[model samples]
Target: MSRALLTALLLFQILAAAATDTTSTRQPDLIKKGWNLGPIPVVAFDSDLGFEYGAVINFFNYGNGSTYPEYRHSIFMEASRYTKGSGQYRIIYDSKFVLEGIRIMADLQYLPTLAAEFYGFNGSESRYNKQWIRPGNKDYHSELFYKMNKDILRAGLDLQGHFENPKFGWIAGTSFQRYNVGPLKMNKLNAEPSPYDESDVLYNKYVKWGIIKEWEKRGGAHITLKGALIYDTRDNEPNPMRGTWADALIYYVSPNLNEKGKGHAKLALSIRKYFTIVPNDLSFAFRAMTQNTIAGTCPFYMLSQIVTVSPRRSFFEGLGGAYSLRGIMRNRVVADGFALANAEFRYKFWRLHLLRQNFYCAITAFGDVGLITQKTKLDLAKVPISEYNSYFSNTAQRPHYSVGIGGKLVMNQNFVISGDIGKALDNQDGNMGVYIGVNFLF
Candidate 1:
């Protein structure tokens, strides 16, 4: 079926199921041994990346009531395209008890981004010009002038054990990533009234100034080996009500940050806690994380992202998107070492038994903050400060703050359709962000 038809069908299914739903006060029995299928349309938009449209189909096997919420085996397959050419084609497999004593997870994905956002270095020290992104403005360069284009292919396997302990475990994983990048492809974007060479845009200035390099400007590949120690006690992995999840992840990269660079390493730490405020209804959740490059050099193309427990969205990167500081501009905070924290209140307002499945609706209020703890190596003095100030950025650099509210529709406590609206504390972070995505941020 065509994407449009599939999306319409997905909406019909949800609406038809809800219309036929029965209100329920009593808890339903845990899922009986059986197979279940769920398929949903994936839709989202970024002003720079255009609208994202796709579908994710999930298949699950639940063996008895032994682990109702936790499945015996799960498979997820997705093939989606974006209007802007930034999208994903992926497949993932996960199992808790299919193996004798361990949990196994594997994923293969190809993500191509047409207009990847790229502002200059130094976090808030890098000026943000609203006019650059606002087409038709007299000062407008190109709507995508501040963006870039890239293609990435990633594949990995992960294993975690110590099931008997439940709260503590050791995990190991390995992955290979390939990236192809360059200045934004504006001819494809139709951002200019007349065709222009990339030489005219300002990202070329970063290249000329040595902020970005010449060799890896086209992108490269690397193999990453990672091992981690974890402490997890959450009751449910999807949307936990209580318990703590803490982990320290370390990475060793071969062929280094770029194809020709020397091997280096990075480290990250995270702790998340969930609290039950009222039975079956309200709860509080919080997470804190720190990430840094410890040994060797990393390419500018790869330094912005840190470790994350939850899966990331296709078109976003770094600290200020829906997956991070919701109301702030995406990638607003990228540095050598960074710190981030998030707090949220989740309230489940209604429940129903629909289409032979359980469904619930919820609302959330949240706050997020991030800071650049260490600066990326740069000769700031050589780069004239007055030129950067020509943009609207205020000189003072501080923690980025944002507050937001969101809504969710969850089915069988696993699949979630989420929408959030957030406001930034700084106008430079952009006025606000509206995002539609999957899963809880933690």
Candidate 2:
């Protein structure tokens, strides 16, 4: 059977299971105590990254059921790889019990991508030609024309402490990250040699044109120190039905470990609100955020990352992609800074007991829009007259928008199985995207 048909069938099965013995009276959520474990096989597909395989395991400690849907301690571990030369391996630990009156979060990750997307700087300003990679087109180049190899080693620690009001908090964190970037590894992909010259690829062309600096072309290592002031009234961290959460964060990247006096400082602001439209069964949620470079210079390799006080995923590099703008191409809006918003309506149609655990099914309809707020400075003087149009659009950047639908299966209201299918409204942002993963994208 085709993947779509298989997915539909599985969804149907889940809905049927949850819909059994449906009733008007709401069932009370079963309080979870002690330690609960959830293990999910990582079987997923991404249009850009191809099929993925591996596993993700989550352990939650409720510590006497006082928090119900919230856990006192949580541990998340995943080991997954894609068929198209990408891999993610990580471990994360979070707990309120680690220190008195404080919450602690720590993570370590290694991500390797043999063909990371590189579509130049700034959204829309950087032209994307579908025909160039189309097999039968006259301008056909290699299929991997807009790709490069990149690997990241990252480790971070964050601490949060509440004020006297408890709703207000302070956050501080430090992280060490290293990026290794270069040309795509054709040998690793086991593909036949390309007929086109090396410069036919955008990365190679950019290097030759001086758009990507030689000192930072291969990537570098840096230490980042960040702090934030936050106000949170959310009832739950995983999925909040009603409340508002906002934070203002500032982070400074120390001078590049490999290059002297090369670094930058940035400011990020995020606000999220949730409204319960129909009590526990339906809700409306929205998040608005912006991140901007406030000082110094930001290298090209670091342009794609979206800094957050607490990262929800292993890869958070995008104004597009699953974590940000669902349907748009991954990292398609790279720039010095950007602004984005997400609005969604979530309706829980079914809730039931499965395998002695409380399970609920929800469907979401969401729209995402974003644009480059601070453009990356590019020196186009090096561009040849003949190739200027192909490399640059010379157009103003505008908001890229997409709309999509998603489904979720929440186990004990903590562990979530989620999927979304989004379509970009503009052809410049590509077509559509299908994502299957964990947690709500907040």
Candidate 3:
């Protein structure tokens, strides 16, 4: 089907659902729930990733509404690809009854990209050269020079157990991933017909200059034991208007790949809270996060990773892009560790309630900021001043900032389609970013 037809069908289905209500009260309609399903037509774009096309299905089981907003089980699945040869296949399952007091959750993902982002490291510690990546500039290299290709297969499973207080829990999970990384190939992304100049590729240049280690140039295995102390008391898990959710996970990465005794420990923490400004019509929400490699060496390719709590449009890494510093170039501020904060003012202008299904449209104004808390180890003294002047910035370290607005189409207080436009505070970070994706950032 055409994009317009698919979108129209989704809207029609939502409206048809809302028009069947027999009463003005939302309670009666929600009380008779057994299973609720929502279909999402994914239409979004990012400058780095290109346009995306796909769909998502959210399955929710309410089981008689004893807990109005909470579901007994939820399953989410999505498949999408960008026009530039990047794609993702994902499936997630969450359930409270899967194992006694423990909630069982699993995330399976397969992602492939022809043009993954690499903007150097450590926020402003190293300068970003716009001319190098921006084609047609006097100092321009190939358009694909700054990008690399990576294929990843990853799966994670967590068994969360709660004690007497439902608000507190202990989480233990394991993640296994294998990565294959290489220089981007112009032939694969429909560039076979017309090849570009490939004499001086960025990835090879870095390797030849000793800037990128030989071992990390080609990706390898990363397996970690994940443990956390989590506290959550959100009034609504999907679109919280009140309460707080705090979590911290420690990852003990086991020695893998060709390197032994290279295992390390990493710490990640996120705290989010929401407050009602005008009941359900208006509210404020915010999230603050930090991550660090406390000991041992982290792979060069993995240095940019940010803790993932939910899905977003592009890959999750370091501090940049939509989920972290909106409007900043994807992976622009990568480092060993970083800190970030995001705040939003949300307003609901429309509500649709019909029969057992309901929907709402919400708009939000937001601000985001992030910076490298720990620098990625790099020695500039050995490198010549000319190289630093050509490829790196000579500026003081500072935070990346952005301000933006977004709106969401929410189904039954659960499935959400969100779009936002953001502008970076400095031109070095990026001029702006436009994104469409799933769920809240936290």
Candidate 4:
């Protein structure tokens, strides 16, 4: 057996032995009451972001333990930084008790990345040459060729209220976001002199060719108003074992701060369903979603942003990477509209109670696929005929596929530590990726 599987088996045996007295009876889960806190040090590594260090703390109020695993209020705080000049500081508050029969969620976040992925628009139409970044290759370019620098400051508030039927609800919210985007800082990225240091990067080339408009090249600020209709019947919020949750959202971006004439409206639809194949021990879950520009033009910088009823992570920019299509390159499929689907089988192989908290470990097998449905309009006339092939493939976009396996360790059914490894079926999407973070992909 592989070392990872062996290690997992050993861990299962150890935990089973530790809970020997409660295994047969399957002792009742401990009921938590009042205020509780779950904090974990953020120590991780990403190929693009470098080593990350910081902390994440979740504060939950269970009130009288009437809801057991469900908390009456939750506050999440995170402050972390990656070695390669990327950092995130965020605070989120969620509560149903804030208003009678209404749920409120709010968040404030600041994210800065020195190297944000920026592949050209539309999937497959933009060729991905791995040789460009290989140091010894004849076609080698700077490793940061496909990257740009970007920082975002965002704040939002959302409220959800049920109709006569509790399963149906309405959501309304507004958010303000400011983005600062530019070419990568090569001086900061390289400690030693290199041949490609002075080479023009993709972002600069796009700006020069007018593919990226000058007005939004440096980024801008905007306010978005959002409304959604939701139908939900999930048994649990963190990792549902049964039921379905679906939502249709419409959001309008107000005119940009720098260009009052620029604005757009978009629609996002998502549906997630969970099936209990073996009660609480084994389950299958799937999510289908599509986001499309309904009216008006979308800025190039904003094309990668995704809209959801409730934001789960600090950053949600992709049709790829951990948040969307696992194992594929991050933000590989940027377009005006896209459709995605993900399916996974989960098995809770072991359960135990320790440190006065309930714990369980699960293994998951999953597959993800997505494609651009509405292509972003690009003006190719400005491109020189001699260099057109380097940037455009003139081919139809197709679905990008990735398959992966993951494991999760859950504490009190609310705090989850998840790790996934995925491989892309097409080389253009990337070879593989390993992601470690909190919560499920949904």
Candidate 5:
């Protein structure tokens, strides 16, 4: 009977059932049932350079399941200093219900004060040691300028089960986080200076499980299976102006890369093929993925993924606002190399309305290629593609190639907002991107 008093009695029965269901029913207009489920408004403005411009607002609400059972809401706001004064105010809530089949969910997040002082860059002040590589963790240069004041609380729970005729799906979850590092700087080696205990606060708990499989027929071939599992305790999840968001770009400029590894067991596999000249918005889905890191270097207090080009950066690996890869700068796709494979080709066009909503817009044409495998195998005819481009001429390489054209809108149908404009035939430099949250990239 105590879990913060049952989450304050289920948030007081959802604000007393949203005030008696807003005076007797009638609030459901979920965008005419395409289901964006109403209550989402966002605004933003940026200039980037000492963080000069800023504005933000995000509000959302979701509820409706077989007649009033699900619920969700979100709120956010921010302001900045040359895009780095780092301000934030947030709130989130989620709910779900199911009885016999076992599927229940609950989530809550709150950030009362999450500030990032950013310390003026070059002339020193940011001081986030180990050079800062946060933006997707790949590039680095430092003069010490770091400031971060934190306040965060998180909550979570999820469960699922599936078994429909020879096919299967599974999901399991657990999460809890609380960290408050109000004033920082810690290191025990290299110049030493530790001891930061002012209720320095850091708590985390995690559990995860995942699996998925598939089959196909109507048009061609298809297959899939997924996986995940994690546990944590190794604090260091700071990223305001970039400096710790996994895939550490070879330890932010070769601190001898792959630091004697850590602890994280990961394994992933995939296979896909769909060839249909024109059926249901044209088709051609071909993918192949192979992930590995069988437990090592990964517990920096969780949340560090952001290794792009895989299901398109899957979950937030780096908190670099915007869905990512927009101009080749965000987690800049790192790793000294270890298993990566990609091949993409997509074309879908329907409705066109770049802005002024009404279902944003649509237009897509894509082509992507990737390859990075060398952990224990490399004899590409005696490694000499000009010494493998002079050892990657300082990062960013692969079979890499891109052709672009992108846009999508369907703030409904599971949600979506996409943008793309790729062109990287070995740095011909052409990447323009914009993505407003999820729905599909997978």
Candidate 6:
């Protein structure tokens, strides 16, 4: 045999082996929905006849001059039936407890088969500490801690479903919620005049509903719409910290302080396009969105829930982690009404498998920007920490920007773990992007 012919044959053999190795050792976890396929007893074991359990722990601590030390800890448990049918029963429980800083919650979700894969009944009780953002020892903290405990109970149902065809597919879901919000009770005024010393005080109760839908295809186009109607009955402050003493300052100065949470309806829509503009080596994607609050009101302190309020606004609304803006704080953007557009570029390379399995890697680059169109009156003049509020003052005036790079580690075809580091261009702090999570950012 000629030397050239031998070399060609060797290359062909390597490619064949690579393909065969991947196909033979593959596991059934890659299959989305199916019964065991190989042997009877073994297939039963590989099928959905077993219970599944998962847990995640997340903790974040700020080092630079935060009011006080704060930490967030949450635990989640999921239990599901072992049968394969249109309906399976599942239950999920989550608890987030903030000992010193607020945000105490317990949530339970009951998912019945046949409804929708992602639909469920969820109920939760949340107790928010009176003064969440303050600088002091637990004992020295403001009177807000003594005034009242902000309590809320929520019950709701969710629906999610998908449809598929040869060239296109779509998914949709909606939810309905009712809330009972109340204040804490206490006996005497106490020698120290704690906010918790009050009694029989009630805030309000209300209902809310929302609908969300999105559709996409094997081609490269998609559309989405989401809207909500809410009757709010909570209080707000200009700062993240809420307490009776904090409120005293506002009531003493701006006697017109708005402590009531109003009701409102909000709607948003977006359309996006994806194109393999550079063959398999490169691709491009873009999205545009518009949002408005047609009716209702929001408490000043609850501002972050209604809009994206962050040091960076451009790409703050999407999933946070290694994906999205690679290197920014989670949900760091805030605004009442805004519009946004995003562009992403991706490149892939093969032939490199670190684990000798079906493992592979790739890199990506992306940018996102957004502008706020409207908002309610924003004032931090009377705030004790006016400087922190300044960063958000003209937030509606600037178009936020970020740039970053990311990488992926894919195992089999369905399991992927990725990370990305990004930095803000105009960032004075010049921090590095940090993210770690599963699956793609998109």
Residue range 256-302, candidate 4, lDDT tens digits: 87776869999999999999999879999999999999998888888
Number of backbone collisions per candidate, in order? 0, 0, 3, 0, 21, 27
Q: TM-score each candidate.
A: 0.90, 0.96, 0.90, 0.94, 0.24, 0.43
Better TM-score candidate (3, 5): 3
| lDDT tens per residue, model 3, 116-179 | 8876777786666676556556666666656788888888887888778989988888888888
Error of model 6, residue 355, in angstroms: 10
lDDT of 2 at 380: 82
Whole-model lDDT, model 4: 0.85
Question: After TM-score superposition, what is the CA distance of residue 305 in candidate 6 from its true location, in Å?
Answer: 5.1
Residue runs of model 2 more than 4 Å from their true location after superposition = 1-8, 11-25, 190-194
lDDT values for all models: 0.74, 0.85, 0.75, 0.85, 0.31, 0.31
TM-score: the better of candidates 1 and 4: 4
Candidate 4, position 208, lDDT: 86
Per-residue CA lDDT of candidate 5, range 1-442, in tens?
1332343345335444434223123233233211234323232221111222234333334444333112233333333223333333333332223355434444454443223222211111112223232233333322112333434454544454444521243445444445343322323111112233322211100011000001100011111112332121111110011111112111111111223322334454444444545543444444444444443333222222332212112234221123322332222332323333333344444322222222322355655443434231112343345533422233333443445555444432223434444554543222433333233344
Candidate 6 structure quality by residue, lDDT tens digits, 1-442: 1332343345335545654333234433221222111101101110111211232222222224132122122232233332222111222221123332222333333322211111000100112232321334353333323122221112222121212321222212222222111233233222234333223121111101111101100001111122222121111111111111100000001111223223444555554445565543355555455555555533322222222111011112221112333443323333455565656665545423322334444566777665556554433343345333322232225554667776554443323444455665544212455543344543
**lDDT per residue as tens, model 1, 1-442:** 1443355447646665665443346566347456788647566554334556777788878877578887788788888876756887898888867677778888898988887767766578787888765767777666666677778888888887764676888778888888888877665766655243444555566766666777657778888888888899999888999999998888876774544658768788889999999877899999998888899876777776675533222123677877888888777787777899999999988776666777777899999999887778864444467665663254565889999998777777877767677889989777887776567787
What CA RMSD would candidate 5 show? Answer: 23.5
After superposition, the stretches of candidate 1 with alpha carbons farther than 4 Å from their true spots are: 1-24, 29-32, 46-48, 194-199, 256-260, 309-316, 380-388, 391-396
How many Å off is the CA of 93 in candidate 1?
A: 1.1
